[model samples]
Target: MPSLVPHLAAVIFVSALAACGEPSSQAAKAGPPPRPVLVKTVAYADRVTERSLVGTIRPRVETDLGFRVAGKVARRLVGVGDVVRGGQQLASLDEVDLGLQTEQAEAEARAAAASLRQAEADLVRTESLTSKGYSASASLDRQQAVTEEARGRLLRAERAMTLARNARSYAVLTADADGVVTATSIEPGQVVTAGQAAIRLARTNEKEAVVSIPESLLSLAKGRAAMTLWSNPGTRYEAKLREFAPSADPATRTYLARFSIPAADETVQIGMTATVTIAVPDRERVARLPLSALFNQGTGPAVWTVGTEGRPTLKPVDVAAYEAVEVLIGSGVEDGDRVVALGVSKLDPGQIVRVIEALQF
Candidate 1:
């Protein structure tokens, strides 16, 4: 009886081994379980980014005014921050010497005119005597030469007189355009040389906003921009790019940009602080998705889109640009498509997935 019981136990153990060796056909047919993934609905719209920089309002035309003739400054009619009109006197030089030179030239011109009249009278008498054969022809010829010489003297004197008067007028420095005097270097008795910068006038008609931008943002400065005065931030003025520095500034390593504000009014004064806003426009339509959603299997860039049937399908996408946290897709995905937002690498075609809806912006 003991031997029979041992044989029965051995048979049961053998049966258990056979059952364990059989293949798992059910698991092989069913495959892996559904993968859980986060999904976002695709939405297409313009993505505009705004950048701002501090700037200053400046006049388009700034000029330095100085005297044309050297002299002691007799009076300074305008000071810094003074408003001046075109042709308005700003300063005057001492006119004592200029007046004397003019008077001397006038006196010389008068004397020459008198000598010319006497020579002409003598020439007429000499010609009359020569015609009657009472005077030698040589005498008439000498008188005619004297009259011509007097006339030449008169012409030279007149030219000197004109120059003297011009010099006298140059003593007064006047504004050439309507502007505000931003600087003055001359006082009541300061001695200034000719063409020295005695005053600085900035034309108030045309105004511009000047700013400095780094090389990364050079394109923004060149493109469309707007500006608002610090004093009046509520009002915005459209700005047009008018000037740009071809090279970076030596110290700041930034390029200077100037934007013309055609709508600037009296409130926008020179030297007022302003902010220039550069809003880059959307050049084309594109869809933006998280970078994690991008899938690549050596073919190209793509994304895994989970369909309504809980299955994921790999779709090729044209990448317009790469951003800090997202990729701009030009095509291959339509609006309202359910796109896997994360863990796209582990996904395969024909694989079912569990969609965890994520907020889409």
Candidate 2:
């Protein structure tokens, strides 16, 4: 009985050691905990595909203003970004030369008038002499011709004076319409030629967004579009197709499109950056996933799809289009398939995962 007790004690000691090691063995066999992830069940729908393009807000009627006559610019009354009204004086040239020309014309007109008066008096005196038989008829006729020549000279001088006055007025450049000045090409003291673009005026009554569309998607840009300003993102403006260039740009091979904004507010300024969203009618049903779920390992695009047993497997997908927040998958994933919506890069193939949240859409 005493020997049996010693053997039993040794057996109990060994059993205690084994029990102490059992926890470590179990932990080693268990490996890592299941990765918690957010997932969404893939579903196909008739999704309306939308494409966004960056564009510039511009006026429908933008005009380049210039001086009517050539002269050195003496002063610029309006500057860039200045609001101007019709007939507002925008700039002026040095009027010294113009004034001199006007004065010369006026003097010539006065000289011609005085000469005509003198000739008329002479003709009257000659006719009186001829009537009294003191002058010959030929002398009176010659005097009459002189008076007519003087009258013609006076008329020409008056017309020259009018032209000089008009030229003087042309030295001052004025706005032709009500608009905002967007650009100024000439400064004070700079010389400008006739019809040279000195200022760019954008009419404020109407506005539009201008963007370039690629040939592949030109057909989709026909209908109404939506515009959101980069400065004010919350406000969205509706735009309709106003005009599009008939031919593509030779260098870019892209078509220029202009969309009229029916409800443009004061916040929408010229030259502001905007985004145009064009929605294309899509009839086919396609699966959509959040952009975070997409994974590209150099071979092609893929996503980590969760199986029915809560295991994640890498599946290659054909992406039709990519949006700001989501991706449209054309094929390789069926409806009801669970896809990792977030943290896809951290997931491994065939790894078990616990879905912390299931997302829709």
Candidate 3:
């Protein structure tokens, strides 16, 4: 009876150990709990909106500086990025040709003056002889006509000499206003035609942002805008629409728009990149979500949507625009659809998840 009792006790202990081992194996097979993630219920609303576009800082008034006369360049007094004042000499032409022209004009004037003196002497002699009846009236009339012709020639020569002097002065190209040279197309010994662009000067006082907008977005760019330099984005400057292209570019189909910055800082230089943003009235409602909610599979942009069963289903979304803090979604998830707002990269399609917090708006 004592042996039978020990056997019964061993069987009971072994049964208890087997029961504990079976439950642990089943729990191990079940795996860990669902991963916790932050989620939000998507809802569409008509919100005031703005769009940002990249642009370049440029002068509102860009002038092409050129020589008034065609000649070989003697020297280029300024270079690209050189700050210049009004009436500053930018370049000079070889004065050899201009000098010869001036000398020739002077010589012609001297010859005309000598001819005028001779004609006057002849007219005076002829008048005296005619008064004493020693010369014919016809001869006096001829001398008078000769004297008038010589006077006309002298006047023409003087005017020609003045024009030659002016031409010589024109050989030295000067700035029309205070500006910075943005480009130089001519160098020493380079021959440039009259009115050919030798240097590109941009006025220093007026600054503008030049950007290209697609045809679809041209209507929104009419009113006031904002500008921020690429290097210094924190400092924003108020800008107004100055001008825009009436027609679109054939290749790009984009219209060029220029925005005038009211008071741009000195640090904003020409050719520097900038961003222009303009607000437009929203025509339709859209779902706004934090940027962290976006995920790009091989196909396109998507977001993890949590279903009632706590399973995450990746829903493809059409992103309308990306803002500083949020992304505007045009379509994809409907209203009241729960979407994972954070830690999207860690999730998988149809993976089980637990929402730690629901984000409002």
Candidate 4:
């Protein structure tokens, strides 16, 4: 029995070693093996990149309605928000003073005309007498000069009368374009100076969103494309990059982007805040990977990629922009390359790794 104890102990030790070396057949078949992460290959397409910004809706052009001549405002025909047509009288100044000036000018012009006529008659009489040898030639010449001077005075008086009529015409403040009155400063009986703003007018149904974009990102679009508008279910509106400021603002380091958004519906109003998204052109296709695939090497950006035989390799890449769930790669990688999406920072180059599974293609 003492000799059998050593053999039994040896046999138990060998059996325990075998059991630890090989998994049981039942345990291997009982549960499913851990599957690797699934990855899908990315397809190349012409996708317009978008950058969104908050903006404000304003009129393309606004004008202040003011009187060209000074007078007391006698009538105001339009109020704020009232739609008016071109040349429509928005307000009127007191015409009594202008009318009096016109009357005085007319009287002066009539008197000048009468005096000119009388001088002309006298000149005719003197010239006749001189021809008949009853008057001196010098006397006739003097009368003729007097008649010419009176005629010149009459012409000057007539011009003054016309100017007075024009001044009276200026008393009526008229709209320059068909627009809605946005403001008014004068009511009836209010005295106003020349060029005093009497009303503010803007195009009724024309609107645009003015956005300030960083100068670094503004070169993406030279012109325009479809943009998303914040109004109503986030409707897409066709916007054209009509104008851009030549200079960037020193304080904000941004340039102004003027988008020409067609106001098809009357619902668009001035001063309404808007969100602007400009679509950037896709020039070149580069490698795109998940955010977890990136790791900083203190010098720049780098990513881990699975090489042949499932070994991790460090690949340097230039990052253009960061997307929602992906980082846009500008260079240093080609399409269809396998990238380590997770645990990339924990890996060293040329290290052996077990692929978890395929991820997004």
Q: Each model's TM-score, in the order given? A: 0.68, 0.59, 0.64, 0.68
Candidate 4 is scored at a TM of 0.68
Mark the 10 consecutive residues where model 2 has the least summed lDDT.
352-361
Per-candidate count of clashing residue pairs (backbone under 3 Å): 0, 0, 0, 15
C-alpha lDDT of residue 134 in model 2: 100
Query: What are the clashing pairs of model 2?
Result: none
Displacement of the residue 86 alpha carbon in candidate 2, Å:
3.2
Q: Write the per-residue lDDT of candidate 2 for residues 28-55, one digit (tens) a residue.
A: 9998899899988888998686789999
Query: Which stretches of candidate 1 lie above 4 Å from their native place?
Result: 1-50, 280-284, 287-361
Error of 2 at 213 (Å): 0.9
Better of 1 and 3 by TM-score: 1
Model 2 lDDT, residue 110, Cα: 100
- Writing each residue's lDDT as its tens digit, candidate 3 over 16-82 gives 9999899889989997789999998888988566779999998999999899899999999998889
Cα deviation of 38, candidate 3, in Å: 18
Instruction: Give Cα distance to truth, residue 172, candidate 4, Å.
Output: 1.5
Relative to the unseen true structure, what is the C-alpha lDDT of residue 262 in candidate 4, on a scale of 0 to 100?
76
Error of 4 at 224 (Å): 3.5
Q: Which candidate is the best by lDDT?
A: 1
